[model samples]
Target: MSRRAAASILVLTVVVATAIGACSTAPLDVGSSDTSPTSVPLPDGPRTARLPSADPIPVSPTPTPQLPVTVTTADNRRVTITDVSRIVALDRYGTYGTAVFALGLGRNLVGRDIATKFPAAASIPVVTTGGTDANAEAIIALRPTVVLTDASLPSANVLTGQLTAAGIPVVTGSAGRTVAGTDAQLRAVATALGIPAAGDALVARTDSQIAAARAMVPRDADRPRIAFVYARGTGLLILGGPGSGADSLIDTVGGQDAGTAAGLTDAFTSLTSEGLIKSRPDVLLMMTDGLASVGGVDGLEKIPGVSETPAGRDRRIIDMDDGELLSFGARTGDVAVALARTLFGRP
Candidate 1:
């Protein structure tokens, strides 16, 4: 109550507060947040004291990533497509199916033209009874996500419109005689399938092989005169123009077509056996595929005036696969070189 007594009490209170603050300043035990009395390792008594063990970090299931399918076109167009699980290939060029096989996407095809000969397409459904006579009803019924169509068809306009209306993407291409153009067409197909690099690689490989075959032929030659005799029954011999596949093959193997003299700019005139004998070809070529149909060389010779011709007399007729030799798609150089060997002993 007195001033001196109160001052002594305040000093006592300050000393007590300071002492309490100093006691609170002691360092904390980081392992335990609890303010309980620290315990030294004591031997287990009635109730055994056990340390906690970490539950094996519940191993999380790993996630797997899926790959997206993409295709790149020749014109540098990129298209991202999905659910491309089914495909149908319909066209005059059976080589298109061969080209698809070359791209390594043959397994994706569910249907093909009747003429498809590639091993992969053997088990696949056939959409037609004949080569170019594919039925649109069957093709549409297959319900493929994509259809590879040959631009070589005269009816491509009608076919494309129908396919588009049915919600199918129709990819078009021309089977080129030259490797350069053929590869470009393959690239377009690859792009549509979302595997551009694969298409490019296939084209490169095929072109290289064809180039190797062509390289085997020596340019130095007398340019032997050659003639492609398309024997329709007896007297019907359909010759090609300068730009035809037959023309390309003749040039590649160092020979000239017998009909080149006629100067028929397009596919033309049925050369009679009389005319063929008058023209006198150094080498006469006919497609091997048609040999059975043409009834072989004896059959060819028996064609009224063929035996009198120099080609038949000398036994110089060469036969090869018509599609492989003439399609000018993948095997142009192969057939050309084969013909070259028959005439000039090369490749």
Candidate 2:
């Protein structure tokens, strides 16, 4: 069998394993009794609701198209594009597609990765499944003139080679999870789509929004020490230390990462019950699916050592959609602000 087939089988195996594990665990009714905090009080004052960062940035009335453009990708590969039509972005975080939409070229998207669920882009035909696995045949069927992706795509080189052989320009951008990394990704996608100026404008707007959100965080507020736990029923992964998108999000919202404080250095690691208890996180951050998989806050508390932590005892958990939580793309600033509001109350 080909490497592509092998990779697909491997991913399928992992997905099946996770599903089996979930089946063995007790199911939580989707509409079961709610234990999570329903309404966090807003700060005492009238404050304007900030616009969502995902909103399109206003560009020139007539966007100047730069064709036959050559640009260097995050992988240091130089690729030239002759056409800006029929684009596909297969990045796991769907940042490229978001950048394209932000650049006012959403209509040109012929296909999207599974993670691209934002407005306009959400309706595009998905060319990948199981998060980042590219369906080569499906992608080819889309007849995308250019493809933008990240290094995380399974069998990236093989996929890119296949597309290149078929006369499509495949450009890979940085998958950095930090703010600066996000900026670089936006610029890279823009350059690949031949709209460097639009990228610059979007980045500036994003940075400004981030700054505004940061300003809303109360200086005197009690910033919670937080831990982001990735759970799929019995399968649990702890997002710890620096470099992880969870760390970036926690920092952006003015919260401390308890995992980092406990000296866990990798992007993700299995946590011991004792280690988790000792970390002493005041709040737990989780993806919505992960939270549901463990039967919500009640089920999460049943995990060893979790109930002992201040977070579990108080049931202080913040959950976001798995994709949006980590995408770190155009909506990152808005996400940070939303998370901040949840933690310290809205302003």
Candidate 3:
């Protein structure tokens, strides 16, 4: 079978499994290779709880400056960075610029993409508007010496082409959404900025914090059945399955991913009312802005399958900032801890 055909078959298999599990009385076993529902300890608690406000992670000391380096991008393009005075970093989730700032290079960043929030990035000039679509004129006017971004930008090639023609180096990083993917992103940004040591330091700190947070999750506690729904008015998507940042976050927070158990393999897929109702998720995860767009809990309960599901009946929903929840940067550990606290009521 062709790769595309195999992928289609895999997705179909998962979807079928999900439909079965959703209708069954058992909990979905997402950690298993086969699509099946397995019984696990179900923690006794109210279906819904208010999420606590999260504090930002403290910034580390600035690293000694390093410059005059050449780095290869994910696209196999080699770009040399001779000056780190004025850097511009862009990505759909703002992970690229956040990573740069985490490496103690915030002072050098002259411009950022629209999604680049947190730390000192909020004060920087935003060069993109419409979800990673760069304004070439606005970026060029900043006089950036180096542009570090990910492939998530819709007009990435065009913007990079324009910047390169203007004699600025453009390096594109990976847009991976896994834990290791975040590490690779940080390394790529650090390499482009000629600060490998700083990158290592930031990664180490992030990894350590994540480990500490993971340790706090109770091993004997019941793993909640969680489903992440991306909602923008009438447009709704279910994010789960293997190889997604959502999956990793769920695992870290000791939750079973309903989408993965249903046999879905993609990062996100259209949510069906039947699939959602059958999945029987105990908790629904959503982006704060997305939940607001749908008119909050009352509005969410009005959605087709949502009203019939256990989550909807119990009003069990957790909402996080769209950018921070998946950015997987310096605050990843904190995010995980916060989610765990909300789900299991553990610090």
Candidate 4:
């Protein structure tokens, strides 16, 4: 599809949008493949997926960006950036902000989104609010020279409009929630910042790390059935389907996607007990915060369809930090490694 059309879609849906900027176009072509859920045996021991520690993902040595960079943004606009004094990378997953840090330009960030929760950026002023939209006045106060963001935010248009009105250069792009898409995301951010070499270096490091993590999964082991669930109290209970990004992680960790296997066609669906039971997920994957919102493990089993499934019966739940688990950025390899260890390793 044309970039113009894609941009329109990007402005609408954060997760299902397939829009991308000119900086890195090819990587978005890789699509998520669905796997049918099967009644496979699990490791039977560990019931949760936890990282060894909460340390932020490591970064590569910083690189200098050759300035006066011109980029054809995802919204089909050519924006030339000459200053990098104050930058704010905003998005739903903090992918762009993380990329800037990986490129060694973290020091230039003037403001950050809620999802950019790394220690290095802990002190940066937050510009996003209400979990989904950004605060225009807060960003205006920072007077950022350029803002790197994408269609991941539901109010991306309004946010961009307000920023543009204030004369801040906003280059829109997408960090698709897929393993391959992460490569393009890093490259796209570097392109926007006039740091192609750094992007390449970061991508290389990410690739090697991901390969090592992938190697940890035993080829002969049985494929586990994983269902990605989004829970927010008793009000919102969504299931991950095709293009949800969870399916990619599930497959990467050597598991089949239960929602996809159960014929969920959309990226997200209002979860129903019958639908979940039909999928028969061996493991229920959730965001740490999302799990807690519903009152933790005990609360999750009490959900309508949860108690009838194998995952609920066995208390098989694997949760990661909401901000990091689906960020789909530089730390994907590390995330994969931790998940693999939990699903298959010894206590």
Residues 1-347, candidate 2: write the lDDT tens digits: 23233223221111000000001123336888743423222233211223344344444334566888898876787899989888888776666776677678877889987767756666789888776678878888998889988766778888988888898888977756676576777777777777888878777777766675566555534556789777767565454556556788788767778888878767666667887887898878877777788887778888898889887777777777655666676666656666666666543
**Candidate with more favorable, higher lDDT: 1 or 4:** 4
Instruction: Please provide, for model 3 over 1-347, each residue's C-alpha lDDT reduced to its tens digit, 9 standing for 90 to 100.
Output: 23222222121111000000011234436675655334443444333322133223324566665778888887788888898889888766667676766677777889987667654667899887655568888888999998887666666788878888999898887766566565666667777777788777767766765665566555444567788776667664454556556778888767878788777767666678977876678888877767788888888888888878777877888887765677676556556666765665542
The most accurate candidate by lDDT is 4
What are the per-residue Cα lDDT tens digits for candidate 4 across 72-163? 88888788888888998888776777777767888898898778876788899877776557888988899888999887776788888888
Model 2, global lDDT: 0.67
Give model 2's TM-score versus the native structure: 0.80
Note the Cα lDDT for every prediction shown: 0.52, 0.67, 0.67, 0.73
Q: Which regions in candidate 1 have their CA more than 4 angstroms from the true location?
A: 1-84, 175-180
Candidates 1 and 2 compared by TM-score, better number: 2
Q: Which candidate leads the pack in TM-score?
A: 4
Off by over 4 Å in 2: 1-62, 220-223
Q: How far does residue 99 in candidate 4 sit from its true spot (Å)?
A: 1.7
Error of 3 at 272 (Å): 2.1
- Cα lDDT of model 4 overall? 0.73
How far off is residue 53 in model 4, in Å?
6.2
Q: Assess candidate 1 and give its lDDT.
A: 0.52
Candidate 1's displacement at residue 58, Å, is 47
TM per model? 0.68, 0.80, 0.80, 0.83
TM-score of candidate 3 versus the correct structure, residues matched by position: 0.80
